[model samples]
Target: MAQWYQTWNKPLKNILWWLVIIGMVVSLPLAYTRHQTETSANQVEFVFDYRDLLDISDIQTNPRTFVAEQLKNMKAAGISSMAVYESTLAELKESRRIEVYNSRDAAALTQTLGDPNENFTYVLFADSATQQKLEPLIQKTFADLKVGTKPWSFKNRNGLIIQMSMDDASIKGMDPDPMTLQMLKDQGFQIVVRLSNRRPFVTNEMDRLLKQLHDIGVKRIIVDGNEVPGYTEENTEINLNKMADLLNKNGIGLAAIELLKEPQKGFSTLSKQTNYNVVRLHSFTEKDGEKLTEPLKKSELQDRIQGVADRLVLAVKDRNIRMVFLNARPVKSLDKGKLVDPLAAYYESLQGKDGAIPRIQEVGFKLGPAEPFDVKTTGWQKIARIFILLGGVSLIVLMVSFFVPEATLLLFVLGILGLAALHTLSANLYAQGLALSTAISAPSIAIMLAIRSVRSGAAAKWKSGLAYALWTLIKTSAISLIGVVYEVALLNHVTYLLVLQQFRGVGVLHLLPIAIAGVYLLFFSENNTYRDKIANIRSILSSFISVLWIVVAGVALAAVYYYLSRTGNEGQASTLEKLFRSFLENTLGVRPRTKEFLFAHPLFLLGAYLSVRYRHAVYLIFIGVIGQLSIVDTFAHLHTPLHISLIRISYGLVFGALIGLVLIAAWEIIIRSWKRWVPQLSK
Candidate 1:
């Protein structure tokens, strides 16, 4: 049976290669559908946090004048929307809508001794307009909380006396200030309401709030605190479904903030209930604003602002972010002996020459209210994905055949069975598993083929060797892109695009292909027969350990650790590297990845050229794995647009090849000079 299975391995592998090709052809249209979905929403919204503006304005000598000036500045800077948070007593005080005092303070103002037992909160309206607009809202909010309120007057200014302590009264949640919303609307600015789950969930109250917001043309709501609005009531009669229904009925969508410490509680459920009507938002936090304005010299400040602009542009153009939320805080400038804000810098970054607005508009986006992606799936997608699934499985089996040629058919059977079981358990797990497997397999196979070509023979001349190296690089990249196609096709869902779901096994995708290539190089590169390869591996395993070997192993391990550490978004970059990266972004609208263009591709190119002549240079094929894997890994970033990823990888290949040619020329000169001047030393 074993001999028969071994005999069929060659034919089975040949058949699997065809399956991979067919799968790639079938997946192309699926990729096109994803491209269409990505391009469906092209409007971006710039939203300023109104609460942060109010807080910053509080530090100014003329708070109202400062706010009015900033509002005009914001409009000039292309900010079209304001994010309004749910009101609290503290916020109302900041806005100067009302003043609150404890029982003792009220007694002092009245010039009468206070009763020792009375601990009521006193509210005095800023003006008649404030009194008329806020009195009902304050009364309703306290009524819902089962707290009593009575009318009062201080010097002819009507106010409310709440039968609760100042501390307790200040924390209660109220509706967003109607006056502020109406004012923002009248100013031609869109409204984005931020809701928190701190208040007791009341169906009628939420419905009324949503309806009022809808009347003002409010399109989206962002959840505040740690939970979405109705999360606390999920287990009760009022659940996320009901909340989602209210939002849907009121035509209000949700804004999914990117990179929160954790996703808002009940957000996923609410989003689903609302038919995935969600736009991705990227927030420039108050801390980030302060850092940008931190007492830097003129040049450094310009660089920091430019860096911020670059990030915002990328967030919109590449990462599917349609909402850019800007926050500002007053920074104490000891040098200037006053509080300064980054508002000016922020405005300039948006509307100045070479700013984010032009760049964003250059990339086919307009400043407007952001809309969610119109995700639609066709019936044909299901049918095409079947072929993609088959192709992915066959590719994995073909990779296994490289090491266990005799078990190719058995592995295919097992892969099919295992995938079926995985699909039964969870379709998402199946897709991610197949995606990761094919991601590693494609690059490993591509590098192995390059190594095989190297083992065959060296080119007779430098020119021919350089041509062969370039061809090999192109071929390897093309092969690696098979995995890219597989990944894009399998994970083509709005959830992945929104980052609600992620492509798992990224660390393995970055590390495993290189390890597999390294293994093939150690035991199988020179051996033509499986038995010989097994013998070579067993001999190495049984060999005595050496101190130098251990040292080399330790160094290799450390290099690998550092390499893996730099694989994800959380990876740290040095200041010089950040400057270099910014330079690349400024120069090339899309920055090619550093590892590919600088380290992986160039070395792979040089290695390919040199391996033609020198046997030891074959070891560079291990380095070649990095470029191939990176090409595939680039697509694994599901949020980035397909066109952007394609352009980035294309640039990586072009630039990497050019650098590799220079290295090849330099190597030739050194070799020739050594032979001419010092033949004995060269030998």
Candidate 2:
């Protein structure tokens, strides 16, 4: 028998290697899909209502102070810097100006003529209407005085470059009664003026406008994501350098805001340039803006807002940029002085602190560490619970060893009542269940009994090699299917919530009785004796741990369950997935179902054959029920209703019985051939 077993080692080794290859093939795609679902992000930096802060400005007298004070609030709120959009105010074609009708015709007439230099001159028109009216005649003399309106939308757009002053005529209503830029500078805010309405007019009024901007506090000028006059692919470098030199002469610097540009390349190039003091990127994200604007309940909106901020924190970490300009416009207007930091509330929620400025130090610069989204227990608590559950299981093992059937049943009823009473007394502490405990313990007891049965039936002389081979197969198959069952529950409840409160803890106590009976017959029986059981333990444990196929299958099934059924999990799954789940519930009012058709009945026949062929394998009968237990246990989840669990059991009985019949026939033939061949080989 030993020689015969030795012949199969090479094939076993080959199959073991194949298992690794198959596991990777099945698991990688599932893992990748799950990662995709979990790791999505929002690209915006902030999500808030600008109107929410108007009433809280430190300087109430200056309307412009609201902008400056709010800028300070952002810094206090942990924003590294900010990018403010600037005006595209165009002077009438005939004069030096900052405002004109937001129109396509005015856009075309103000085009600057010279290859961007300090020497360019501007031609002023009496009015933009007159400028377009005389374009036919004006073209003859001033060929370089360009005019068109490709940039401005028909909708009114006021160009407030920065809310500089209520008093400046040039920026009057655009930034009337707004925050002071100097206040932002005094508070150590790195201010970036994004050139929103890009030039013909920017270059047309470049020198004087830039001078006025520099005298106050504006330093860096954002040149990207803005269309400048004659901004061509070939002249990008020249245009960028010219803008930098213009800002440099005013004791200012250039900043690049990458909107649609390649992030790494744009950031890398701008970062390397000495004149570029601050390089950043800004775009309002969809989920951060539009989605949040949808008609959601107040709590849902807050959750979405926090989600956006978390993604923004991640975006900063990923890009290593200094500032992000989230379009705060989409954030629905809030009540004046609601004590919300609009965007900062997101980080505050995670840290559980108000107005915290801590940055995510590891990400180099960010709002702060992402906080735990859910509550979790400490390690000692988990260990203590496991100990209690094992104690409960151990009690059942004791009962089966010492008590008669009637006594065991009677005590179980009393114990359950006592437990329910205790649960009521400790309602504050929550109703604790032994489900996880039983989920773990039932398979162990089943395997242990199956092995004890094999040892008890062994030849009077121990260590019959042929007998060991048969025992190994039975052990492997039983242990392999442990905790293995088709998942069919309709709810998305996690089956193992440690803090669960329910009366179901007593239900799993039933397994304790089975464990007890098996313990007496398999280990402590007067007929079988302890010495024989001791002889079999090593083989049983070795076979249990060493079977690779079952271990791999168990792991694969776990991943599949998580991938398909986890909360927020979506697959190629739809109604069909629901139907597949329902099909496994193993029940019918008058007919048998899945469990009976696929597992229990077949297990029963196969187990019966194995038990009769090898008396020591008699525990296969209970092990077969363990397979049924696996089915009921799955539906036995607290989240599943009890009626469904019974239906699932019946399904298992019918389907399993059918499959068990087939497995029995195949196993009978295999065992007969093995027995016949063993005698011939023994010679």
Candidate 3:
């Protein structure tokens, strides 16, 4: 033993350990309390939408002034684009007719007036005799025929979408506007011409409409796919592609298709065109299973907006796309001809509760650098500060242990308290989610714990195979679980939507933990002997290989999940999947744990439990660490909630531990049975 080891006093060490514990218990909650307010992460949601020119234009008023005001409001509200119709069918001359119908034709029209939802105004040219023959029907249908030279209109659940026909196929653009669109353009406006088809989905007249918008300086087109009802699987893609091509020729560069299905092949091909644009629109058309309309309660309106915002962050995180369009008329339900308002409710939805914006810049998206921010996060900087703080604490632990060997208990207590304090400080400081901070710190903690465990025993007893696996798993899981609390701090302050946007991965955070672990292992020679140093290196390298195996195993598991979901028998997964499903169905009740929870957490927990004592328990526990990776992978997708992730990992720890105990019990039983059978065979 070293001379310094002999001088270490037991009583002093115990007192120091208790002091560290006392300090931690008090400071940790204080940090949590300081950061307990609502989320303040800054990120701008780039949202745009289409508004009816009728929203601001009224034939009854000075339409130009109203439209210009709406446009200016749009610019101020951070709206990236705006859309208006070339013209509705009701606006066309062909839809209106001056008819002095004979009494017989009027009688026939009167018979057909029962339902107004069906298309009406069919043109008929018949002799006087034929009209007389058809005049015996009810007078109800004739009521429509008596009204001469007026436009026909319809009302549906959406209030009104006026239909019109092309009066002259040659007239491309809309009727004259109040202000030159060139002004909006000069101010950096992106105007899209919405082609409202009275005819179904085919773009027979679209070629003409595109020319008019192009002539009017409109650069984008929003196509309503429902307008094209005649297309099939074979022709829809081709027809859409052709429409896109037509738009390109007219110098209309962007096409936004509001299709309900996955985009067809032709759209994919057209999207690649240099001048052609296809914004894959995911519209929040429904609220509580009904289409969005006015007259909804204020609470319902707020809920719907929040729900859409949450989905937006989740939907676009890794999609590799630049823009998203929200199809909404979130302004209060205005009366007909009452469209002179900017969508204030819609803009309110863009912000989370208390106007908490996430860190859009951290997610590698910056709409405008000069845009003012009410909130911001330290991002990777806070993580670096955390790791540095942790490293200092670790060094203090090492130095104290080196001089006073009897102070081992105190050092251990100090380490835990320091880690807890660090966790509290980081949770308070970064204001992003906690998983990233935890994930970055985990591997280092595992390395340090593994070193401590190995130093306490004979090196050879734990050097190879199952022993190494057990050690790695236990150490890894303990640290991973430690990281879980970091996110628990954030649960009440933000929604899953804001959390996903702000808490996206940092490259430094991903690599720092592994780097810290690697560097620490290099100098952490077991027993301070050259032989032990080589062994420690070898062991750590083996641990790295195991970590690689865990990673590969995670990927392989994902591939298997995908394949099973897509190609399994009748699309049914294997029994193991079913078992997880059953477990979740029973335990999670209606809340529903995801496949990540079912597959990953329990397995990691199992690894953690098995890692307790058995020499080969690490093999089982390795799966648990893989579970942690699965959880980490879930974050990359930006879909899982912070609380949900916590629940999943916590359940995994408990359930996995139970499973491990069950397996160990069964194994012991099998061993006893084998012994008895062998003795009988020998006899």
Which candidate wins on TM-score?
A: 1
Cα-based lDDT at residue 426, candidate 3 = 70
TM-score of each: 0.97, 0.31, 0.38
Per-residue alpha-carbon lDDT of candidate 3 for residues 1-683, written as tens digits (9 for 90 to 100): 55555455444444443443343333344224323321222222343443333432543266556556665765665565555544322322221211222223433654543333422233231233422322221121232224222222222111111122213221333322213244445667655555533343445555655675577666555454434322345676666567666766886543333324444234334444423233333344424212334555778767555544444543333222234454433243454334323245545544446221242333445442111112223233334444433433433343344334566655656665755665677754344433455445444454445544444443236434344544454556655544443333232222222221234554444345444544443545245765666676688677745687889989977965663453211455666755555455334621233433445444444443344444343333333333544434333322233444445555655565455455546765898899989899999
Q: Write the per-residue lDDT of candidate 2 for residues 449-546, one digit (tens) a residue.
A: 55455445642334443344345434533432232221111111211111122224433433543455466554554354456767666556677454
**Compared to the true structure, candidate 2 yields what TM-score?**
0.31
- On residues 45-79, what C-alpha lDDT tens digit does candidate 1 reach at each position? 99999999999999989999988898988999999
Question: What are the lDDT scores of the predictions, listed in order?
Answer: 0.89, 0.40, 0.42
Which of candidates 2 and 3 is the stronger one according to lDDT?
3
| Candidates ranked by lDDT | 1, 3, 2
Q: List candidate 1 segments past 4 Å from native.
A: 1-7, 233-238, 456-463, 528-531, 680-683
**Prediction RMSDs, each to the true structure:** 2.0, 23.4, 18.9
